[model samples]
Target: MGMPSHLGLDDFPDDVADEFPSDVKLALFRRARAGAALRLYRRRGWNDHAVRFQYDRAAAELAIALDRWEHRETNPTLF
Candidate 1:
């Protein structure tokens, strides 16, 4: 899928959100927040160290979100 021109913390379809547990939703929220921060730092030409920190944080958050999403079905009681 093509990337959106803009990003927001609450980007998913509202109806779909009800299907997942709170932990999964929270993971996605964190991932989106980190991604937005990373994008902003890069666009504003922030210091390399700051940008890299956001980059790493965003990557970690994304991994966490993906893992939660994938495992949610098998472990519905996960937090």
Candidate 2:
């Protein structure tokens, strides 16, 4: 599936994109899209808040991936 034009790969910071693998980058983008969707749903007063859970989970996953990339970048010998 293609990302929305506003959320395309070019939107990512160069440093972050260069450090992350393709899969990780895609995951981050997906998480961002989920967060945006969650915001829209909340703004429109949709009753179901279950999407917030999904958005939270995606945020957590993205955070973990970013942490791993940062750690690896700083500790090259450990890998």
Residue-by-residue lDDT tens digits, candidate 2, 1-79 = 2222323356555564665566567767878888888989988989647888888787777766666766666789843
Which digits, one per residue and each the tens of the lDDT, describe model 1 over residues 1-79? 2111123325555576666557656655765666677778779888557656765675566566556666655578845
Report clash pairs, candidate 1. Answer: none
**Candidate 2 residue runs with Cα over 4 Å from true position:** 1-19
lDDT per model vs. reference: 0.59, 0.67
Compared to the true structure, candidate 1 yields what TM-score? 0.53
Question: What's the TM-score of each model vs. the native?
Answer: 0.53, 0.65
- What overall lDDT, based on C-alpha atoms, would model 2 receive against the true structure? 0.67
The TM-score measured for candidate 2 stands at 0.65
**Residue 16 local lDDT, model 2:** 45
Residue 24 miss distance in model 2 (angstroms): 3.4
Q: Which portions of model 1 miss their true places by more than 4 Å? A: 1-12, 48-72, 75-79
Model 2 residue 46 distance off true place after TM-score fit, in angstroms: 0.4
Best by lDDT: 2
